[model samples]
Structure formats: C-alpha cells, structure tokens
Target: MNLVALAARCRAEHDYNPLCDAIPYVRFLGISVSEEAGEFISQLAFRPRNIGNPALPALHGGVVGAFLETTAILELVWAQETLMIPKIINITIDYLRPAGPVTTYARGTITKRGRRIANVTVEAWQGDRSRPVAIAHCHFLLELTP
Candidate 1:
C-alpha cells in the first residue's frame, strides 16, 4: 500500500502510530510496528539488503541504530499522541553482540519526559530479550502541538 493509504488506515485504527510507517528510511528498512494496550513493539524483517558483512552476514550497525532510533521516536509519538515529530538531540548506542540474519525485535521505554525534552531507552534483540544485540539511549527534543 502507498504511504498515504497506510497512514490513513493507521489513523482509522487509532492503534499503532503512522509516523514510523510514513518515513522513507523506516520503510526501506522494512520495519513493522504493533501496539498492544499501551505498549509498543517494532520488528525488523531479515533481508539481504540489511546485511553488512558478507562473511558473517550480520546486520549493519547503522541498521540497528536506525531501528533503535525509530523505535524511540515511535514510542514517544505513541505515548504523547502528538502530530509533531520529535527531533533527536543525541543518541548513544552500545553494540553488545553481532546481530545475525534473523527477525529482530525492538522495544523502547520513555524513561523521562519534560516539557521540551524526553529520554528514551531502547533495546534490540534477535533471539532473546535477556541478551540484547544492541542498546541505545536517545534524547529527543519534542515539538508540542498547539
């Protein structure tokens, strides 16, 4: 489906936020989002395009970083219910282990939120949540809607 149509469907459902689906980079990465109750979950499908090393066939660090950042933004949008997109201030990512060629999952938590800024913690795991492939801490400058 086209981005506009997908976004319209998302709005009609009033569940998952369409901001992630609307972005071209997120779409290129093939990210899928779902919301259960108030919690948000994002998934990255395993694809050859995402592979960085031909030897190990591991996921690129950039892809994982983008996934985590997207997760943070999606979580913030879902929690705040705002139309304005948040500007990322800083992102610190720690690569824990190699991300194999498999479906990866990411979850972000809004640790703190103020008037103009919010801190989010995100973790991406392939096989187990207890052992994350990468973790990221992101600070975003929120734009408030009038």
Candidate 2:
C-alpha cells in the first residue's frame, strides 16, 4: 500500500510504536514510519543537534548504531504488528563513510525469522543512496527476561 493508505490503516487500527511513543527525543528527531517492500520501515533524518562535533565534524558512531538498532526493532515490530516488545541480542555495524551534514535516512529489512531468532539488516545514508554510510547486521531474540 501507498504511504497515505498505510497511514490510514495505521490510524484505523490505532497501532503505534510504543518505543517511539516513549521517547520524546525520537519524536523530536522526526522519526517516521513508512511502507517498505509491503512492510513498515522506520526512517531517521539528520538534525543540527545530531550533527557531529566541531573537532571531527561528522555523525557520531553511537548515534548511527542506535539508529540501526531502532530501525531493526521497528522492522520486527512492523512485521508483528503487535504491542509486545522484543529483546535484541546483538547488532553489528560497519561504517562505510562519514555521513554528511544533510539529513540522513535509515531503513531496515528482515531476512530470516525463526522460532526464537530473527536476522535483520539496516542501512543509513545521506544523498547517495548508492553508497550507504553505515550497514548493520542484527540478531534479535523476541522474548527475554527483564
């Protein structure tokens, strides 16, 4: 379905990401949900505050990692279309280049889902979708004791 249709459906169902709802910062960052390969995709764009320091002047590695993880979790949550939260096991990120000062976007795709584990990959980029600034491989364990 198209974005408008997706939004309508989500509105009709009244489904939302609790994680996104919980973090006001995330909402402030302008993270949005969209359709991807007939599934929901979480998107993150760059802001001045998310910009890098004066010394190095590039996006922080930790920020990139967090974006990847959040995107991956959104992928899982989108696939499930439920309220229960999932526990992530491990996430590995590879930085390809320095993400420019412009707004960057993050997207996640799930490759495999098993009884207990799900494999996901996420990409973040700016300007050149041809070359991603970072790519992440994530392994998620659905249920875990707190």
Evaluated against the true structure, the overall lDDT of model 2 is 0.70
| Winner by TM-score | 1
Residue 119 of model 1 has an lDDT of: 93
List model 1 lDDT by residue over 1-146, tens digit each: 65435544666686554656568899899898887675678999999999998799799999999999999987876675344667899999999999999999999999999888899999999888999999999999876753
Q: In candidate 2, what residue range of length 10 has the lowest lDDT sum? A: 1-10
lDDT of each: 0.84, 0.70
Of the candidates shown, which would achieve the greatest lDDT relative to the real structure?
A: 1
**Model 1 accuracy (lDDT, Cα):** 0.84
Show model 1 residue runs off by greater than 4 Å: 1-12
TM-score between model 1 and native: 0.87
